[model samples]
Target: MRGDRVTNEGTVPSDSRRFCLYFAHIELAQKVQAGREAKRTLHEAGVAIKKQIIANTKSNKSERHKHLDELEQDLKILENELKEKEELKRQAEIPENAAKERHQKLWKVEKRAMQDLISRNNQMREMFADLDTNGDSLISIDELQKHRELDTNPENEFTVEEVRSILGSDSIDLNKFNTTVFDQLSNSYGKLLEPTRPTPEPTPLAEPSIDSITTQPSSLEIPTDEEDLRTHTRSSYKNEDDSEDDYEEYNHRGSSSIATSLEHEKHIHDSIAPEYDDETKRLIQIADEARNRYHEVGEKLLSIKRQIDDSKKQSSVDTGLHDEYAAIIDQCFDYEEREYTYRICMFKTANQIPKGGGSEVTIGYWDSWCGPKDNKYLKMKYSNGATCWNGPPRSLIVTLQCGTEQKLTDVREPSRCEYAMIFETPLACDETIATTSAHLDHVEF
Candidate 1:
């Protein structure tokens, strides 16, 4: 090649320089080709592995589907049985409908009686307490007449003579309140008042009246406050000097008071003699028996129904969880805090960078989902990161809450080197977003 372009004692030529440039390009091309070949081999291996995984998943799903057919058949039988029972109960209910009216009336009457007595007793106790305010179980005639509330009405204001007759003196000792000496002194009441007819609970009354619901003694409206109507023991005291027999005798003295006491108890329980005819009673018994049977059948049907529902869920086609978590793959989120910049690389690593230009600290590495079993994907646990100065290795729990877009927020150390952060992500929403992969030709690797 040492022709006219070369010298006799040749050193270099312009054309020879082109040859150097050509070989340099060739060497660069060869290196690039070698790198592409290695990348291709690795890419092919990854594809093969992915196909095997897909095949295994399909095999597992097929095995699960085999039991699904039998489960569906069982579910159908249970559904039919449940429907039959429900129809039978509906038919039985039609016959029992007539008896229900009488039963409801009886229950209402009984409730009215109890509520009325309770109302009356509460009022009576309040009135007596107001009459004797000095903590002495004695009602003074002076206090009774001069009392501010008693001035409201004539009925509330009794004459001095009338008060003396009841007390046997100027003061009435409530300890001896049942003493019926006033009965001999005056003929104010010749006959017992008529038995009070039961009324609805909402009606306020001072005293039980024979006029039934038509009258409510306005002076002392019933304390309808539910707390005032509670049943309580009659609180009394017997000093050491008082003998047991004497105490018993004092409590037993007043005949009229005794009659009133017995009548009060009667009003509470045996107030209205429920008179159901023999036919009505027979109908009630039949209805009650039917109700019991209906309830038992209903409970059994519910149990079967729950099982069917659970079976249906188990039998449904398995939509592999692989897609459920695909949205989080390779996603990274950052949160700016007062003292640190927190970062979370989903299924990778979590780290916190100091705001004051210090080295970034490794918080943790993604381990597994640590949420409750019912919703396993709600939380992501990361563990075994850089060890703390005087504590165990670092760990983190990323709590996922449903959001329109992904975010890392509220980064904090719940305990020393035990980090926690809230992650708002659309992947946490109820519905999973499915994704598709597209193949591209002429890939470098």
Candidate 2:
């Protein structure tokens, strides 16, 4: 029975109990399945999330690398640009430096040329002054001939052949052959004439006087009858009172003789006074006139001497401008960052530059009044020039010439902050044109 009952309970189970057991079993199985499924799902989800995270990290790293590379390229490009700019700056400075050097060279050349012109002009002026005769402004053939004749020595008179040899073929003009032919021929040869010796002064004469050779005459004699007078006197004296009267008469006669001699000497002196007075007045007048003439002659000689001294002083003082060229440069132009000007006078004090601005350039003449005749070169003062940054004020130099007009020809900058200028003027023209022509002819001979 127990066996049968256990079999029945197991086979047919109690409805409620069976159901409860079955339900509990099913629920437990479901819960366990659900837990298992949930665990699997969670593990799958974690794996997926890890995969996504790794992919995202790789993408982000790649982008960062790309950006870094781009930044590096940009840095390289900026460095190359900076290098190019540095090279361009170096190239730009070269031309400016070269220009400054070129201008300095030009200034030196222009200065030398101006000096040469001045020297040539001075030489011509001297020749003209030497040839000008008779203190006249013009030089004619006749006047030149007189000079030639005066220059020739009596002992060495020029022969026709000698004259021809000295003058050459061009000495005469066939169309103008008159009495002037001889004169022209002589003039052509006059330059070759030598200086003559001067004449000596004459000696003075001795004077003679009439008073040194005259002799004086003797005094006249007078006689008296002393014996007769003595005999008569003795007879009268025989009477007692007669002897005393005779003695008194002899004393009276002696006194009368002395009085007559004194009266004669007084009359002679009174007669000569008028003639002596006239002679003295005449001698005084003549002496005064002679003294006045001597004073006039002395004054003339002194004036001549003074003139000669002045001429000598002028000649000595007038030296060539070349010697003082450096000093002249200092006087003319001042150095500045912008430019420089230079000026020089051949034989006078020169101003180098001027003060101020603009295109107008002014030139001056040599200080002629302060210098000698030989030093009379034209001087110029320039003004309104370039300005400097932090240096001296604008200035200029004085240039000398022998031309017809005073004008600036050109201005330029040849160096860094340096300048050069060219000028022309009438003051630079040759004043002795005729004399220069004559000199050239002489040189050809």
Candidates' C-alpha lDDT: 0.54, 0.37
CA RMSD of all predictions: 18.8, 52.4
Give one digit per residue, the lDDT tens place, for model 2 in 326-422.
Answer: 2122223222323434343333322335435544332333333232366544333333434456643343343443323334555544543333444
Output the lDDT of residue 214, model 1: 23
Error of 2 at 109 (Å): 92
List the candidates' TM-scores in order. 0.32, 0.16
Regions of candidate 2 where Cα sits further than 4 Å from its true position:
1-277, 319-402, 405-445
User: lDDT by residue for model 1 over 1-445, one digit each (tens)?
Assistant: 4522655787545676767767777677677766655445444444454345456656654754565555566657766765776666666666455444433333343344445445544433344444566756666877565543333235654677755655578876533432332233223322223334443222233343323322222232222322321111011112233333333443343222222111233444554544444545666666666666666666765765675564454444232254345434556889997888888887778998899998988999978888898877778899998999988999999898655456875788879989999987545554221122222233221
Number of the top-ranking candidate, with lDDT as the measure: 1
